[model samples]
Target: MTEEIEAQSFEEEDVEFFEFKQFNKNALSVQLDTDTVYPEVIPPYPSLLAISNTYGYFVAATNEGFIYASTQDLHELFDNSEAGSKELLSQKIHFEISEGKVRCLRLSSDQLTLIVVVEGGLVLFYDVTKFASEKAGCQPFQIMTFPDDIRDLRPNPGEKYNLIAILLVSGIVYIKDYLLNNEISKIEGSKVGERFTAMCWSQKGKQIICGNHLGQLMQYTPEGTHKSSIQPPQELQQHYVQNVLWLESALFVVAYFPVIQEDDSELDVFIISRETKSKTLYIKSPTICSQISSDHPKLPYLYMETIKDWGPNLKCLIICASANSADINLIARDESNNWTSLNLSDTTRAALPLSEVNDEDTLPVGLALDFTCMESWITRLTADENTEVPPVPILYILNNECDIVAYRCFHKDAFFVDESFSGMSPPQKLPVTGHSSGMTLPKRDLSHSTTSTQNTTVLSAPIKTESPITDPIETGSPIVAPIKTASPVFAPIKTASPVVAPIKTASPVVAPIKTASPIIAPIKTASPMIVPTKSGISNNSLSSSISYDKNISSQKKIRTPPPDSTPSRNLGSNQPTEADSKTPHMIRMNATNNEINELHNLIEELENSYIAKYHDRTTEQCFDNPDAWLIGDLPVITSEINRLEHEASSMSQALADLRRQVNEFSHDVHIDYVKTTKDIEHLMYTPSTITVGRRGILQSRIKERLETTFKVGCYINFQRLFVYTNLYLCL
Candidate 1:
């Protein structure tokens, strides 16, 4: 390895490049009408799906499987309304279920009907408000069919909640939710008979799974009871179960994959057992290199992806939500790795001080689920905004040479970013914490599935292809939510490794990169190798590093910045000129590193975009230094700033070893204040007694004795005053 290139190299010293990049609010492109708003949305594809913001109108699914109902976040809520303000409506639905593109879309949490699952088969259902809000597409008011041709769809559990389940494609799986004979229900009967390729709904929903192809899973319960049957142990399900997830009740993780391939198809990860019929083991099947799934529920951290023995084939993605789900934030691509957030909770088996374990408080083994997909799985998980904690999870990962990342799994406590910056500072809008502790995520003893065998896991929808992203990494395993409490909760699926083939119905259809984009960035280095500060720099600044390797190797002096906009994207009149914007940035810098990893597959092309939406406080943009890694999911704050810089460097080295093991020192940590001198000769000889309230002292007990002797004004993390001074409460 005679290579130290340490003599010095970073040089792009032409700093004068700024004119239009100035509109930075972090990122906001907008622009939509993909044909009068979302007219069945289908402009391009390979994977970039999601829509259904529950009720205030919104719904979607497209890639040629067609379905749309909007109010904007559904991908077409335009506003030009003649200029006088408001307008976001988008509707297009006459119910077209030929099933070839659409991979997943569900909206039952009562916003009324809308489900579309086509990878090649079908499951279409739509209503978009049945008739008028001003009509958008309204048709098929209800059309159903599924014994096995679907491929992943979901909706079960609280909040306006409704009901939905399907994942067939010959892997046979179904759940329907209601309305049997006349439509909607498909008459139950399929339970474990085998054929499910992915399913999920075990956050305690009393049985709703299917994983088949023979590797098995097959649970059922809408009251027709069939609950029981799990496999994967005849040498890893022999192949099948593309994705399924659920993380905090126990285990039922599956990413499986082995139906046949030769050089790099090996993925694996399974932990199943929502009560009984077991399976366990994780993290050794070639040490997972990419993963994601925690679409936020407050930091349930999971993300890791790597590959770079030397260069060019580079590959990056790292973040497994650190800062106390214990150790995870390890990205690399030659940038080395580390950004630790270690403490894997188990407060003797976590009971919510909101515990998260794998190490902290030791006590291992709970909510277990062994995994396998030969290489990696789990590609999206998010939740965060103190909905109490479990919902701030963000994970999206994949790597062999492809990248898609987005990460951040909770870690704030400077009393939760100073009481959430004192109720969001200034004026006052407050109201954020509504408590969803979400089964506090870190508990797993495993045993579920026996309220007459009710286990669950489904992943459906598997049509992928939007590659062009950056950071995030590996599986954490715990998902168990439909929980009204029978315990059994294991469902995992965050996929990648698609090949499928066969589809050319003549070409010309394109849309699928609408939003959720960030392909993981804030790039990782969670371990060791990072070198490039351009190595060191000198030979007379190597002529400014050969003018930044000749401004990133001149395509005529690296200058193609225009076109952040001008409204010129024709795609076909055969328009894409300027030599098609210098060919995907020169085929994204000379392709191959597996097609320059499809220019960073941010889970199939920048799902809605991001640099940091971050949310809550309103505006705090900065980003530090990002050039690429944009595809949605990337916020495991360098293992939570390496767990608050290792607890502020172990609290400044335990206050400098407690002032060098002092012989005389006190431990009070003071901050007291009690001012009040209202004249009248100081209130007639200081006799001020105003205690007509609850016995005597209470203004939250003198602001907890002057904010615990003055540590007031700033705090949002000693676990939010551990119940106001360790649980004695105001007194």
Candidate 2:
């Protein structure tokens, strides 16, 4: 009973392990709409997608031949913020291909060049940095035309030269220096029915590994010299290799066997050691096949994370997307280097139901794997002092229905802390370092201080009293600076109340100070008499007083507006008048009117040009014959219709003739078959009719019958049949 219980627990643990490794489809998903953000029209069926390595920016192409490059980080789609979503939807670069629809897009590792493959075997090389910064102009710096359509282009991983491997639809590979516009070498498939289906460059770009439809992996140097080849094992014989990836010591080959039922087809992955040229491991996975034709087969997308310190052998998780299903599979290796796979079809179905009327969507059209964004997201999610956060790739799957779903391939529990441990310790507070973080001090009222200083300076300027002004000093304590006397005659006196009456009655002195600058000039000239006699102020207070005095002196230097301009200043500060507010409205109205006039002129020009051209063409056509004008090209249309009818009649008559000939041939064959069958039957029945006696007579009769029935060119053997009949009669 205990053993059974332990086995059940082990099974449950295995279930949990798979649950954690599966992709969480519900975490993030967003549908892309071109109309919402861009002025250009992009159809719903996006054909190509390419993502950058640094920022999570991507470029997408539509079937209508429109390509859009995003300006904002695609990772913002995870937050679901309105502003970020809007920014992410907006495109910075728009390119229209006039040749044909874009088939493939490859962004270089350094993110410098963007390689675009269109129909008709045209390859365009664009300067991504220039177009992205300029935000205008859709011209490629370099264009190369090929004889066949390009299947894929891979930039070299080495930093030696700007070299790229171009794979054509006819199973030919070319190593070219795109910068120099030179073809270095060309690698062609074998003459005995072998063609490359998928290819990848080595780590240092020293070699290229290509997979063919015959389940063979071929390696070649950058100079196009054949290095080695690895054939598939017995179980994977006659399989079509879909993709090949070389990571460190192992070469991963993804191959699938063709079957009538696509759903029953198994995807096989073989891991081979590059050093020994031997197979190390094999894996089989069930996958849903796409409805695409075999003539233009698409290889599965494979992404492997940069292996760190997981193990001595292959250690990173491999993510594969075959573009045949909405879900992806994760192939990982444990510490023991054992390979295992987990499928996320069930999770995807649960998250995105296919039964909903509007939710009916196609399989993934493109897959983008980003490790930079996923690492940052994992860091933020597992910020609660958790160190065991698993490294997973951030995969963005774009479907035909314009929806982009993000997958993390791991459970949230890996980044979640237990509730029991959460309450054990309080959250640590981050140290405040900036000035904006600490307590704020109240602002000093500089306006009020300046007004009080002006009043003090004016009152002391006109006063002729011998006693020093000390009564106003107590009232000005809030003002940091002390007041100065206008003359040295009253500098020695310290009486506080002698000038109180004069100061109150000196209202007439303010008029001159406000009207004439010469009367208040003593305030600036008496700076030597403004020394502080009090010793109770602290150093801070004194420093603040000096600053205040400097501010007051600076304000005095500024030219103040006259009283005559006070009404204008008041009108500016208060609500605007009718005429003042109408100024901007009038300007806007005039600008709009100008724009309308310009548009009207442009439309009129276009209309006149079109009418003139139409009239000219019509006149030219009617010049030769007057009847052509009245008929308006009816005879041309009739001729086209008659030609089509004649072709159809000829095709029908030929088909009838072929049918009659087939019938005549079949009749002749049937008559010959009946004659041959009767001849063979006559030979067998004539022998059986002979009795046991009269062996000589029977032999002579059988020989005579065989010779007459079967001549030299007859179907039956006369001599053998006669001998057999004679022997039977004797017995």
Candidate 3:
């Protein structure tokens, strides 16, 4: 959409920009390795959970090597005092350089800390305050790792932060605390067997429910005793279980497969009784899966809803967003895991970004929906304290107030109105003291964007908007910062010295070394201002942009158009105006006016009006009215989007291919290097009997005279080479 808009307003838009970089006396100096390409690191928008209303923040990792923290104050990250050319946040990688692409992130209710699970199965406990503090940067307190990639992590709702369930590829669940003060216990099934992708604590808090790679959703005692297997739809039986949650007395599960071509490719949510085994299928759409959640744990009649599905294709996903859209839906679930909603239309919603397209391009990305709707992903749902209603079920429905299905609550109304609560802090800024130019991380180029906008805005807007619908952060080249040997370091293993291998596949612990503390640079007393990644505009310094503004300044620069019509508010209000229906560029000039604004805002109103008004007209007519846009069915529409998406995906893939080629080329070079070394060693150890002089004539004659050596694997059909047997020798 940005690209397309750029083209549309190509002549009119004053393409503006701002940037931050190394220009100070302490200049941001790189290794100056011209021969080596720097690793690209695109930052993913991460969610953090800390001791609410405390002095901390948690930065979640992306599929790439970067972590992100949002402001404890929502007003900071989103609604800054004003808009600017570049949007900056205080949150950063607590210690700099992500352990790897983060797989799952969970913030305990305390909001004081968070658990970060990276790709390749590494877990790190981050102290959000250290980085956010005006004094110290966010730092790591502990590091615990596993062999294979981590699947998911969750704290027991039944326990007061006493235990957390960690899922690993080894098919074991580790129950431990963040403090690691206790030993880790492994949980596995007694009857059926396999790794579990999703887990949930029963309402009574005595039982646990889990979902596996194969859609085997089942219940068990908290003590690890296995119970009955809750059957899934026959078609979805083999699908990977994404998430499981319990509402009151029921167990709800959702699972789907990677392949979206068949009818069974969609997400499936099933509700089953722990005792009776009576079950129902809430949603069976090929492309849409239902999600269950509740804000109603503390209130009645007010239900939280949610849904899960791939937005465009397997590449992009639609998760529940705090702000709603028209792409996906949200629903409700109970402790038994059964979805029990009165209607689907009344459900709230959220959105999440997915891959650009379904391609093999090596990019790191992941999303976890709220626990209320943690069907296709792992996310725990907690209500916003600002709401007066306690435990109101936040039914984030999948459909747009259309075909509704199952709904229920997890904790019940009694769980609501927990007065003891803490609010989240904004993101923290920690210096990356250990970032080294070693490991290769794949990332997108923040410096450039295409001028095309072919299928950008054609998404099926969901009722609830997750994060941005698009993968805003391009997973870039691997981060190869020369490791500074940051402290709190784990015991490094023998350096595999992966000279130039796939970073993803490179050994986790490659260097063996004693732990050392980071060499601290002068700590910036003030918060670092927002620095732009591109064209130089922002002064990359701590004292310049970030200081609290004394007056309303930044956002005033953004030009907002005027409102089209004064809206019809309450009874006895003024009648509608003629100009309202026919306005061109409607803007909300008066933010305070209740009479002029559309109920859903212009974005929603314009979109709804466009579809309702122009969809039935001829394409030629629709094109004339800029207000109306083009849309098609899931298949036809997505097919076109697939084309544009493939175009962008090709670039990512090409980069991956380039990296692969580099690794291959490097391997070849290494082999040649080894062979050269060996030849030299052989020359010195068993000095070649025949020594050639600097002049070639005598040496050629002497070499010709000597018996020719066979080249292995080289087919020498040379009839005259009787002395040679092998070809293409490592000789």
Best by TM-score: 2
- Candidate 2 achieves a global lDDT of 0.48
Which candidate number would show the highest lDDT if scored against the true structure? 2
In order of lDDT, best first, we have: 2, 3, 1
lDDT of 3: 0.35
Q: Write the per-residue lDDT of candidate 3 for residues 430-529, one digit (tens) a residue.
A: 3333221131221211111111001011112111111111111111111111222212111111122211111111111112112121212222223321
At residue 677, give the lDDT of candidate 3: 40
Q: Per-residue lDDT tens digits of candidate 1, residues 243-287?
A: 545443444445566667433443454444344224332321222
TM-score for every candidate vs. truth? 0.21, 0.47, 0.38
Candidate 2 has which clashing residue pairs, if any? none
The reply for model 3, stretches above 4 Å from the true place, is: 1-58, 62-73, 81-86, 90-94, 129-138, 178-181, 191-193, 203-206, 234-237, 258-264, 273-326, 332-731
Better of 1 and 2 by TM-score: 2
Q: What are the lDDT scores of the predictions, listed in order? A: 0.33, 0.48, 0.35
Worst 10 residues of 2 by lDDT: 4-13
CA shift of 343, model 2, Å: 4.5
